[model samples]
Target: MNRALLLHGRQYKPFKGFMEKTKQVWLVVFLFAFSGRVAAQADTMARQSAFRVFLDNDFINLRGHGSDQAYTNGIRLDYFNVLSGRRGLFSWMPRAGENSVNTTGVSAMQVMYSPEDLKKRQPDSSDFPYSGGLTASYSLHSSNPAKKFSLRSEITGGVMGPPALGEEMQRMVHRIMGFIEPKGWDYQLKTDLLINVDFTAEKMLHEFGRGAELVGGANASLGSMNNAASVYAIFRAGHINPYFNGFLAQTNAYRGSKKLFYNIIVSPRAELQIYNALVDGGLFRRWSGRDVSKANRPTLTASELNLGIDYGFALSW
Candidate 1:
């Protein structure tokens, strides 16, 4: 009976130790899970509180050297926020990676086009047509830092021609800058409805330390305003941020380390333009007693294939 009791005590001691170790393992797991959840919540809150504004104008183009022709002035205003709930138009979109960030944004934009000589009341027919567009767009952007990829989708609606107020905006700016008044307004593209959908995808090709990186991307647009597809590569150097964070790295709200940002970028692109309403005029015919082509205005014969290079520098805090 003594031997049996001793054996039972030994067995009980081993079982008790095993049980205690199992409990400790579960406790560690629970702590880790709790900490992960807290971190995720913090990230979500930071994204929700972030906002940004953007303005673009060809008048500020560094390569133009004060000349305004072809694709001229443009202005854009954007507001963005992280999507808190997956119950919207963009909810069905697939994320790029396991831990991808999603953002929704709205924007208002105005674009202007003109010939080389703005002083001529009746510009050369072969020159770029006088046209303008004003649009409002809703967009969805998704990015994955680990995979170094991003996706963007957007839908836009608005109007073209005089209703866009391009001529008036240009005149106001020119008057403010003490430049010569533009001469051709009546010959601008006629009023027309504008609607388009666009999608873009970008991936980091390679990274050369923290100072430089190469990114490649493609964009597609379809609608009454424009139908085109293009591919481009971007080379950025200087104090650059992660490009996967967002367009122009504007959506890096969770980054708390950087107080200032600056970069020099060079992008080369090739586009196959199926159609461009701004250059080709409206798709539908107008019988308003105006002498015009099938598109209801004077249009230029634009190249179906276009190649261009862009250089710019950005500084922001």
Candidate 2:
């Protein structure tokens, strides 16, 4: 009877421990959700002009990830508002200030890991492990704040450090692949250089007496994915309630000028996304880049197609 009692006691202890841990997890989640109340209350009083700081901070948190290619993540933050102070610009059509589409109010980036080390020990978990990068861009445009339609243009550049310990991994992979190939062996290193340019055009529209808006734009890039472009549309479902809005953007990709010459081809990428004041996430499919050499041309393809999620608060005034 004592031995049986001891076993039962041990089982009960584990069950008790699990329940305690579960309670703590719930508490953390509850706190995270409730923490936004403070920000919401402050925003209610500010009327949307003084919330730039919070918006900037949130943007960095959402889009920025560690910089390691094998483990580092990438982040991007963008904002476009045409209703603030420029009411007269909407009266004019087809033409707006040249700087309108060229401005980016907040821009910054950080590198988080080194590629050489990543290959030495491949982590099992899906977290940013080893990578580094730099991001720089210029923001232009904003002659009128109340314009119904606004335009924006931006140029960005950055370099992504190789995956954590990728060189060693590449060497191993090359060795393995070479052993299978006949006589001569060649190794191609995977590295990234980032270059991007984008334009945005936004307009306000009404649907059945409801206040709504439309956002659409195109983006082009070279270093990271060869050539990529995107267009998006967002609608405001709330009236008099500016805090709740919904937006969707569609992105496409294609081979570019450089690829034409190198025979390094890639099929276009396609993506769909939805975002609101509280949440943002998306689904995407891509075609990988090919390697074209003097002797042979290689074709690569996308290896992933899936959805991703992000949880955060956004404040813009």
Model 1, 221-268: lDDT tens digits are 999888888898989886656777654354342243555656666777
Model 1 earns a TM-score of: 0.70
Candidate 1 Cα RMSD after full superposition onto the native fold (Å):
23.0
All models: lDDT?
0.64, 0.28
Cα-based TM-score, every candidate: 0.70, 0.37
Where does candidate 1 have its weakest 10-residue lDDT segment?
1-10
Residue-level error in angstroms, candidate 2, position 94? 12
The best candidate in terms of TM-score: 1
Deviation (Å) of 244 in candidate 1: 2.8
Worst 10 residues of 2 by lDDT: 1-10
Assess the local accuracy of residue 53 in candidate 1 as a C-alpha lDDT between 0 and 100: 40
Residue 124 lDDT (model 2): 24
Candidate 2 residue lDDT tens string, 1-317: 00000000001112112234221000001121222111111112222221221111111121222112222223334342323333442333322554232222445443232221233343322222233445666543433234445555556665544432333443343365332211111111223555655555555443335433333333433334233333434443222222112110111111122221111111122222111000000012111122223111101112112121112221112
Model 1, clash count?
0
